[model samples]
Target: MRAAVFDRFGPPDVLHVVHIPDPQPGPGEVRVRVLAAGVQPFDVGVRQGNMPWAKVEFPQTIGQEYAGVVDALGEGVRDLAVGDPVLGSTMLNGNAELLCVAAANVVRKPHNLDFPTAAALVAASQTASGALLELGVGEGDVLLVHAAAGSVGTVATQLARLAGATVIGSASFDNHSRVRRQGALPVPYGEELIAAVRDTGLQPTAALDGAGAEAIAQSVALGISPDRIGTIVDDKAAAEHGVRVVRAGRDPERLARVIALAAEGKVLMPVQAFPLSEVVEAHRAVESRHSHGKVVLIIEP
Candidate 1:
């Protein structure tokens, strides 16, 4: 099996694919022949050695989410079978040709969802859905999403709209059209952000920040109560402003629900793909912070 691994944390050049021993399913786990893997900011953090609590070995594997076909099943795995198409969250080993993960954690992929798109939804879906749930966003509310063109914010905007909230999304002028297409009114970010949102004629009842510290401050300027402001990106700013840091952790159920919506064409995630061998370039794209959509590694391509 071949997998992307890094011996030392530094730049994108630190990542490279190399042959490693194939892993077999252990009890309650299944081995998946990975078709695609989502590249996340978390993966970038892991690669740069920024996550102090992430357990890292010298030659460490660094992906968190993947979609693939099941090749083998561990003992007691009754709900899924060999050859099943599944997508799910994994820990530090998803960017590989084959990965073993707990069968309980994997979600069955709908036939309508391609591997890359399915993989793309895994983390962002979970994060966005969880954040919305934590924020209690719903009918009669106006939700403000910072960095709305991003993976998490894209999902967040759509899901909030589905839940009956009016959405105002902040992005650069270039991405405003994309943001509006995601069912939100688009507002340009930076110093003029508050005025931009104000011009939309909607008072933000709650805010979700996917951008950094500046987003938090701008949301506060909109007169949204600190309790109603949730941030997944800037915890330090969240703490300073007395805003909630919504740790929208991984949840397979949340991911599955969003996946179902995607399969039905109710939710969409655009993908920018790189073949597995070009893992370094993929990492660099995510690091550049200008990727147009979810960046994914097409493992089998």
Candidate 2:
């Protein structure tokens, strides 16, 4: 099996592909022949040695989401078969030719959703849905999403719209049109954001911050209550502003719901894909914060 691994944490260039023994499934686990994988900011942080709490060792494989076909099953698993198309969350091994995850944690991929698209939805769907649920965003509420053009933000914008909320998304002017297509009234991000949002004439009742920096503080300046402002990107700022720091934990059920919506074309995340041989470039794209949507590696094709 060929996997992306980093012997030591540093820049994106540290990531390299190498052949290793194929991983075997344990009891209740299933081995997947990975077709695509999603790269996240979490992966970048882990690679930069910023996440001390994450377990890491020399030559650690790095990726958190995968979509592929099942090839083998382990003991005590009877719910899925060898040909099942699955997508779900994994840790440190998704950027490989194969990975083993608990069968109980896998979400069946819809036939209409291709591998790259399914892989793109894995983390962002869970995070965005969890944040919206925690924030109580719905009808009659005008919601502001920071980094609205980003993976998590894009999902958040679309999901919030589906829940009957009017969404205002913050992004670079270059992405304004893309954000608008996702059902948000797009506004430029950063120092001028508050003014831009104000010009839209919609008062935000809640805010979801996927872009750190001054998002929480700016949300405060916009007259939104601290209780209704949630952030998945900035915890320290959330604490400083006395707002909610959303912990978008992994929940297979939550991911499944979003996947179902995606299958019906109700939600979508654009994929910026690179082949497995360019794992380094994939990391660079996610780290740059300029990728059009979700950054993914096409591991098999």
Candidate 3:
């Protein structure tokens, strides 16, 4: 199997595709023939050696989410079988031709969702859904989503709207139209953010910050209570502001629900894709922090 691996932590160029021995599924596990994998900001941090708690070894593979077909099943795995299309979260080995994961962690992919699209939803779906649940965003509330153009923010905004909350999304002028399309009243970010939300005549009752740059402070300025404000980014600012830092851990059930919504066209995620050979470029796109959508690696086609 060919996998993207890095010998050292540095820049995108450090990632290279190389052949490695195929891995076999253990008991209760299934081996997937990877079709697509999502590249995230967390991967960039891993590549740059920014995450202190993450253990890295030489020639390490890095990726978190993938969509693929089941190629093999290990002992005790019964609910899924060979050739079943599935998507799920993994630790650090998604950017490969094949991967083995626990069957319980995999979600069946809907026929309407393509491989890349299914892969794209893995992380953002879980994160956004968990954040909204934790913040108790619901009817008659206005939800402010920072970095509304981002993957997590995009899903968060749409989900909040579906929950009957008016959404105010913060993004640059370039992404205002896109944010608005996601059911958010688009507002410009930075120092003018609070005023922009006020201009929209929406009072934010809950806030989800995907963008780290003073978003918690801005949410506070908008009169949102600290307990109602949550951040997935900038834990430091979250602590300083006494706001909640939402971990939004991965959950297969939550991911599956969002996937079902995506299949029904209630939620959408744009994918910027690159071939597996161009994994370096994929990493670069994610690191740029300006990609219009989720960045993914096309591993099969």
Candidate 4:
């Protein structure tokens, strides 16, 4: 198996592909031949040594979400068979050509959803859906999403609208059209965000921040109650502003719900793809914080 591994915590240049022993499934797990994998900010953070809490070893494989096909099942695994398409969250091994995960954790991929797109939805879907649930964003709520052109922000914007909330998303001027297509009224980030939101004629009742410090403070300045404001990006800013730090941790059921919505065509995620050989560039893109959508590595195809 070929996997992307970093020998040291540093820049994306430290990451490289290496051939390693194929990972086999343990009891209650299945080995997947990865087709596509989503590259997230989490991967960049861990690679750059920003997340010291995550255990890292030399030559560590680094990726968190994958979409692939099941080729082998562990003992006692039933309900899923060889060749079934699946997509789900994984821990630190999704950048590889093969990975093993608990069979119970895998969500069956819809026939209509392509591998890269399925991989793209894994993390963002779970995060966005969980955040909205925590904030109670639904009918009559005008929700403001910071970094609205981002992977998580894009999903959050669409899901909020489906729940009957009007969404205003903050993005770069070049991405405003993309944000609007996701059903958000797009505004620029930084100093002008407040004025732009005001021009929309919608006072935000709830906010989700995926950008950093300025975003949290701006959400506060917009007059949304502190409790109704959430930040997934900056906990320090979240604490300083007395807003909710939306952990939005992993929940298989939550991910499955979004996957179902995606399958039914009610949810969609745009994907920016790179081949597995370009793993370094993929990391650079995520670190750049300007990729229009989910950054994914096409591992198999």
lDDT to native, each model: 0.94, 0.94, 0.94, 0.92
Summarize candidate 2's per-residue lDDT along 1-106 as a digit string, tens digits.
9999999989999999999999999999999999999999999999999999999989899999999999999999999999999999999889999999999999
* lDDT of candidate 1 at residue 273, scale 0 to 100: 98
Candidate 1 TM-score to native: 0.99
Off by over 4 Å in 2: none
Which portions of model 1 miss their true places by more than 4 Å? none
Better lDDT candidate (1, 2): 2
The positional error of residue 181 in candidate 4, measured at the CA in angstroms, is 0.5
Clashing pairs in 3: none
* All candidates in order of lDDT, best leading: 2, 3, 1, 4
User: Which 10-residue span in candidate 3 carries the lowest summed lDDT?
Assistant: 292-301
